[model samples]
Target: MSDNLARQFLLREDVVFLNHGSFGACPRPVFEAYQGWQLELEREPVEFLGRRLHDLLRAPREALAAELGCGSEDIVGVLNATTGLNIVARSLDLKPGDQILTTDHEYSALEKTWAYVCRKTGAEIVVVKVPMPLTSEAAFTDAIIAGMTERTRVLFLSHITSPTALLFPIENAIAEARRRGIWSVIDGAHTPGHIKLDLEGIGADFYSGNCHKWMMTPKGSAFLHARPEVQGLLDPLVISHGWTAESKAPGAKGAFGNSPFIDEIEIQGTRDPAPWLTVPAAIQFRKDNDWWGVAAHCHALAQDTARQLGELTGLAPLSSPEFCAPQMVAMPIPECDPLVVHTTLFERYGIEIPVFRWQDRCIARLSVQGYNSRPQMDRLIDALSELLELGAPQIAAQG
Candidate 1:
């Protein structure tokens, strides 16, 4: 599909990496750019952060805002999706008996954020279970909407769930939440750089995502985008010089004065801003590479890999090709402990994959990046076929 040089990724050898959805593999050029910015930061710590970091950081957010179809004021660069969610989680002034509604398929770390908030504020976390072997967008939306009650104050969801890798239909949910005066905070950890993102369209009060996972940026590169009206409600998880607007500092939220939402969350104590600043470069690298075509190609591979694995394992897939996510697929395997299966894949076969236990089912999540070839998928298929057909349990005993 996309045969451009920009599609070139520098993944490590000696292992078949099919877990890009967990943490994205940075492209060679983007990696170089990340290093270059890091070098500049070390070269002049004072000038780089004090004099130039604000505008330098803003440029990428501006470009990314355009891509995300939201104003730069609505988006603030954060360390990761977890960090972004924490900002919103801490800022929410939840009271006792208030409810935060969410589905069972949410990311664990994000769930922890809400749980911690609930513990502090006496808010109840209402978990609505969306039936598995999930079929349509309507089914997902309806399940969540049905869970809303009078006590529901916040609705937290994953744009692309980490455990299942399914994309939720949030627009209708967000629109409905607004009508009922409920807050919708989405954890879009695997959304950016994987699928097309429209922050305005989602109508979410707060949205946070990671650029490192799918955008192919260096680690610690991510952002949190919030709506204008709701932004005032957020307090940064970390407080620094940006706490007071009366006297604007170098890292202060300029022009937009006394916005406790942004002021409270945006400035964490000084660390290297190099990764955050390198986002524009990563965006440019993808643009030059015809990223759309690459996505299509990767989706095809995901479909094929899922099919092969399913045929070999005789385990039903979580979703079919139509409902199945393009970049990643979560497939079930035979009755086996996940950690044991995972160790067999990695330690025994050197297959870098994610085998996780969720509820009653065991899931094998496969992610397809540009660097992944059919041969790589073939390796996985062969390994699995050997395990199943050759009586892997018996083979394991001998080893």
Candidate 2:
């Protein structure tokens, strides 16, 4: 399975690819599906784009909707999760005293987006720290809930954090937000395929996730899910014909519908919709290959890597194995120039991975997919052991 799956991907054979969490490596089948859609669009631009685009997207969207546990109308395709979150952040009716509460473990790009929005509106961003070596789920929830105040207009959080790679207990946060009548916006970029998502069950006002990452879809495919109640609160990031469509009729049901949230956001002009049209194929790929079994195997590899690294470094993992992502784990590395180790591993060993400093600690994250093998995990473990032996000084010189 490992050898065959590895061959199915377009990733180079020479480099050991361990960074699937960053941007997913598409399988040959899915890539072909993406290209087929593109070819169909090019064959008859007018009929494909003008006549068939909306209908062509329906099946894929419905397939993803079932996986996400939402109705077809609740979800809309976007370029990526960041763009979906941007649409939510920018559309919010924030005022001077309003606050967007989140944790320190969020992706930096979304943090910057909120910062930009705050700069425009006089809102405040309160980032609470969910400390390393996390103690318990209650403690994690308490830390975020403690920051909530009367002015807390929104609760923004990551379902699976970026740098820390911890699967946060967001159900508590979502429940609390509902009780307080505050909006809950969840960034679930790493959650869609990595973890089972029940959007209707979770009940977040706005949810965004990326299919291009863990789902192994072609890049530029993602979704934004808005509950029917709050759909009007969001406007499209790129305003187009959907905005003006309502003028033709009383409520303006454009090509898609009068539901401004899905219609406005989904009908962006002159963009390639090929990646989105291939979602069902990616979903089919997962089912055909038994992705849950693959995820379990990959998870064992991640935990093994973390345990081996922890034994070598004498440092504890950021969270327990239970709280860590099944296929992605973040472990603390011994104090060194993170970039030096990152460079040494890639140049000397032909290993592709990410090592960086988050806050004051140096951390390396490992992402294991179906194609990864035990030997590949050992190669990273062995390379790190060799690199850290020389310390950052020798590693820096070699770099």
Question: Which structure among the candidates has the greatest TM-score?
Answer: 2
> Could you tell me the lDDT of residue 315 within candidate 1?
84
Using all chains and alpha carbons, the TM-scores for the candidates as numbered come to 0.93, 0.96
RMSD of each: 3.1, 1.9
Give model 1's TM-score versus the native structure. 0.93
lDDT string for model 2 (1-399, tens) is 369878889999899999999998899999999999999889999999898777787787799999989998889899999999999999999999899999989999999999999999999999898966785889888898899999999999999989989999889889999999999999999998999889999999999999999999999999999998888777787877556545334344555653666667778888999999999999999999999988988998899889999999999889877789999988898888788788878989999888998887888989999989999989998898888876656655643
In candidate 1, position 196 carries an lDDT of 91
Candidate 2 local distance difference test against the native: 0.88
**Residue-level error in angstroms, candidate 1, position 225:** 0.8
Model 2 segments more than 4 A misplaced: 245-252, 396-399
How close to the true structure is residue 18 of candidate 1, measured as C-alpha lDDT? 86
Best by lDDT: 2
